[model samples]
Target: MPALSPTMEEGNIVKWLKKEGDTVNVGDALCEIETDKAVVTMESSDEGILAKILVEEGSKNVRLGSLIGLLVEEGQDWKQVEIPADVGVPSSVASPTPAPTPAAPSVSAPPKLQHQPGKLQVRLSPAARNILETHGLDPSNVTPTGPRGIFTKEDALKLLQEKQKGKPSELKPVVSPAPAAVPSPSQATAVTSYSRPAIPPISTPGQPAAVGTFTEIPASNIRRVIAKRLTESKTTIPHAYAAADCAIDAVLKLRKELAKDDIKVSVNDFIIKATAVTLKQMPDVNVTWDGEACRRLQSIDISIAVATDRGLITPIIKDAAAKGIKEIAASAKALAKKARDGKLLPEEYQGGSFSISNLGMFGISGFTAVINPPQACILAVGRARPELRVVEDEEGNEKLEQHQLMTVTLSSDGRVVDDELASKFLETLKANIENPMRLALN
Candidate 1:
């Protein structure tokens, strides 16, 4: 399989657009491959005939550089294409061997041990082994469900859930005794009033319906990577945070003025521009944490976090400091659309120097975001709301006035950006946001 992204070690074949014996041309989309970050379409780079497909659809964890299919010249006999014996078959497609039947034990023979110390009798898939090891679960406790008495990830997960639910006594529901006779009309009315309808069990497509108190939604490849990376970031990095409330009245007025001319922009667009300008003024905050040293980035590529059905992905706006407000707005809009549609290429979503996460549209007033690693800082933006504050009038009298204010919190890595640097970055950001005209000028 082709490596669709830098961190992609394996991929899932979502579907193959081209089947065997089909004519393939350069730039033709061959299949949709699920990478660690997104579901990306793998396009053909050469003209040929798709002779045979070794990997089937819905196959997951196919290693990089593994032969997935055979291609041949257009004029060649595609039917006679021979499979290479040296090609390693993916585990997903390999046929499982039937487990051997054990011989009957002799009357005098000692009982055979199902499990022995330092060795497990059950076979396990790599994913199943990893899950068991991570949770400190004994392989013997989990029943093998795969062919040839092999344990799978699903088995490991079910065992973990069973363990988490505690013992049988704790799991048993309390049973109420039945009434000796039917209730009267008044009593039945009261019971109906207090009774709640049973909720239907939730289930995902292609998965079995839940038969218990909870439903299990399998984690996608993207979500698994996100979990691993976020966990590492939280454990390994020392994070510091600083927040500032900026008056966005000027920005609102500018947006309205632009709307009249058919030039539309959003609050987030202005935030991106302001952040880029602030980073330009204070370049220290634009650096990333490199092992053995701190590497300052020469360009300001801001990654904007976009939520997708699969997971959250950050698509970068390259050279944001050099782009105008309109340019930034346009880029953000297009990138967000691509992210939601899962059409972003690796370069479009990788290697950003900084990141901005805005939950303002979701009605979040204020929240701190985790820093995207390698990059030193991430700015979390909250929704702008009208607030009453005491202001000095021209005549020097204090009066309460309503102003649009937004809360922005900066999360920085202490290894690269200390508390002092984080505060300065937020201060500069607040200044730029309060006076949005400076952002346009810059």
Candidate 2:
């Protein structure tokens, strides 16, 4: 499978787009693959009738070039070929999975000739070498640290990880010092924080910046995928951004009313409902563009981009416009928990009709987002802040107005959504957020 992002080591098939016995044209979507970075539809490379599906759905940690299934040209014979799991694999491409009952390894015949050996050296796989290269290490430079005279994949990876140590590996221009002149125990008393850094903390109390030496971590599979896709979108697709200020006073009041007694709904939950109602009001905003054709989606499965330890993940609230605030909140919580635990199956993150990304919690004031592929648009919700302006009073007296204003930026693929359509969609969203009661009917 072609990598959607650099950090992807494997992708799990979410759903087979074309069922067995289905004819597939070149470039037809064969299945949906969930990589570390995102869930994407993987297309077939060859035109043929799908002969077999080897990998089961919901399988985890699948690798590239591993047999997903068989695709033979139409009219091929139906019998006698044993499609071994190891077929099409180079001897060098290490198997990601091991058989439960592994056969006895081939016996190495004892050397008839005399042998003289000191250190056992091993060979590292190309994949291992790539990992090393990514860490700015040369294979020839490091001594093999594995057992036997071979450099196994695990050994190479372990060595690389040790070298990285959560920090970007920097090749020393030259060895700074020899292994000498070490300090004594008394001279090496442990000290934690430096005195000067505690003087002024940033306004956000809990958020802390790095002090002293710091490490820049390598992106995980999901993050790498996000980067690549976003880069591709920004470079390949022309994007036009439209934003409108949404008054959240009504929304805040509605959420408080909903939260009375046993019922509880957050501001975010309110936003989710408002967005769904707005999406239904302007159907074009819920559409995905497939280059030549724009597919209008029937359901509003709104995917909320959630933060996780491994990377940013999005979990959908299916038919969100029809769900109550409590249900959405529960779904959001469950999905977030699953995502954080890395227990989300591929299907859990797939099939989002539209997406919403909020930076409100982080106090960000309006930023454009990269559109997820096949998706027509994404809404970037900003934080609410107090704003003041002059207004005509009911008695005709000029008055200074104080209000809660939040900015919502809608980024759409120019190829599908024209400027006028995008504007109207934004207006609808603004109205929904401003008139919170209208969203409650859902």
Candidate 3:
């Protein structure tokens, strides 16, 4: 299997686009692989005839560099291809020492499988083997449905489901006794006042109650990695948080003006532009924590958090300090669409100097976000709400005025960004947001 991402150690085969005996060419998609981040298509790098498949579809956690299939040169007889003894062995496993070699013969014979009497020779996929071994099931009992009588994972799951259905349920229905004579209204009232209500039986402190059945959904490769990384960030990194409320009335006005000119922009687009401008002004906040030292970045690449069906992913806007508001909006829209479609390439989502997670559209007033590792800080934006504030008029008369205010929180790694630095970053961000016309001037 190929490593689809930088941190990907293993991959799951979602499906194979090509089958055995198919003509393979350069740039032909061989299969769709589920990586630690997304589902990506694996393309062929060489021209050959697909001879054999060692690992089948639905196989998970196949290690990198492991043999998944075989390809032979064009014009060669694919049927005559020899299968290696360790076809499915992981690349990390040590190879056994070779025995003493005998003198080569002038002529070589074709390889063949050795079969014994009373033994069933069944071809089982890797996933099917795992299922059978885990349940201690006999392979001979399962009916094969794959090509050449191969027992697939689907067949194994079907057999297990059938066996479960065959077993009788242990819990029997309770038989209720006949109801007593109905009580008068007065008697019912007295009984209600004196008698305690019926309460369901509760399980013990250590054990859970058998309330309802739930389906066991397997975690996808992306979800697993997300869980691991977030856990690590929370446990290993010392995080500090700072928040500020910015008046967004000017930003909203700017959006309206831009819309009149046939240029559509969003509140998030203005925020992104403001963040890039603030990062450029304060380079100390735009840094990452290397193992040995804190490295401040020269360019400001902003990673925008996007929610997908699989999980949360961050697609980056490179050199945001140089891009205008229109360019930033277009880029964010395209990247978000690609992110939701799970079609982001490694470079599109990988590196960034900082991150921004906006829950403004979701109507979240305020929330703290976990800091993505290696990066020093992440900015969390909340929804904009109208608030009445007391302001003094030119004649020294107090009056109430309404303003659109948004709350923003910055999560920082204390080791890289101290309390003062975090406060300064938020202060600058607040200024740029409140006065968004400064973004165009910069």
Candidate 4:
């Protein structure tokens, strides 16, 4: 899978672009991978005669670079390639020779997802929509803060509030109501007036009552797991947050230059890149508290957070610091596509040296994220905004200037990451982002 994302030790096949008997050439898209950050697609880096598939659709996660399937050179008999015993996929999914093959594809496939596109469905309240329209805002750009992606009035109201207060969204709000039971229309049986509680003539008011029936959809295995882990993370992680204002002028300048080709890259991409570099610089931050010992790692594979229909998922952007900007963009795209498709295996979503959650594109300026433990640090990014700064003129007169400012938060495990390490990492990340060319130069 080209180690599409950092946390992706493996990826689950949401769907196979090439089926059994399907011919796959070098650079052909094999499948979309759900990495921690987004759904990115993987290509056949090598020319292959696609001998087998490891896991089928709806399968849990799989390891990256593991034989999710094979890409054999042309004219080679697939059966001749001995399959490893550790390739956990069923033989049927792995070797499809004995299985009935599907019809050959009608056309040659195009390159897989260059970058996974995010779905922005906002169900805004009518009032919120009006405010957004009044501000010449496009709700499409603001992620919905409602159920199943329905933007609510509160979301728009809050967004507007932030804009007016000389602030952007500094806090990534998890506006979850008290865990109410599933919404169900009540089936009621009416009671007669005679059965109602009696009242004096002067006090006479309401009478009858009714009882209703409902069926509830309990929390799924995923939801339950989320509840347990998040709660545990909060309860035990001993998290301490240190936030810093970051200058994104250089990064923004580069992004605008890059977007000219209609090749859109979000600010979060730099956030991802910065987080990866920071992890590399402070390898101690790339560790997990194993309850007994602090386990620091040599390699930094940071998982980027992507929200999915199922819930919050963190797909990895593996070895992010090493990849070029174009490659990072491409990998992020493919990872996102696979994530939404729910094809992620356990490995794709789990294991990370660090986590980066960004709400900057959504106009958020700062926020603290809960600890994603065993990993010592989780970085949160807020939106970029114009800030007034005093600068000296050539005449030595003070002048006010506007700068694009962003806030980056590093939530670290109190047990290991001291304030000095966290602060230095944040500063370096800020410097790198502000001078994004450093990344290119390096």
In terms of lDDT, which candidate is strongest? Answer: 1
Q: lDDT, candidate 1, residue 394?
A: 93
Model 3 Cα lDDT, one tens digit per residue, 170-248: 2112346698779998788666535555333322234565565233467889999999989999998898999999999
TM-score of every model?
Answer: 0.79, 0.58, 0.72, 0.53
Local distance difference test scores for all models: 0.84, 0.72, 0.83, 0.69
- Give the worst 10-residue stretch by lDDT in candidate 1: 109-118
Model 1, 1-442: lDDT tens digits are 9888889888899999999999999999999999999999999999999999989999877888778888899999999998777876665555554444443444553322234454445667887777665555665644476644678878866765665657442121335678667889878766644455654433444666667546656678899999998998899889888899999999999999999999989999999999999999999989999766799999999999999999999999999989988889899999999999999988999899999999998999999998888899999999999999999999999999999999999989999888888888888899999898888678
lDDT of 1 at 24: 97
What lDDT score goes with residue 374 in model 1?
86
Model 1 misplacement above 4 A: 95-151, 155-213
Steric collisions counted per model: 0, 7, 0, 42
Measured by C-alpha RMSD in angstroms, how accurate is candidate 4? 20.8
lDDT of 2 by residue, 1-442 (tens): 5565555677766677787788889899888777776566787778988877777676655667667677888887534334765565322233543322322334663332112243222256565555554554444434444322334455555655555465334231233456755667876676343554432211222445645433335454577677887888888788999999988988877667766766777778888888888888888778887778889999998988888766677888999999987888899889888877666666677778788899999989889888877788888999999999788988999999888999999888898888999999888878878887787676
RMSD of each: 9.9, 14.3, 13.3, 20.8
Clashing pairs in 1: none
lDDT of candidate 4 over 197-308, digit per residue (tens): 5322211115333334233344433455567779999999888889989888888888999889776777777778777776777677788889999888876787887777
At residue 41, candidate 4 shows an lDDT of 66
| TM-score for predicted model 3 compared with the true structure | 0.72
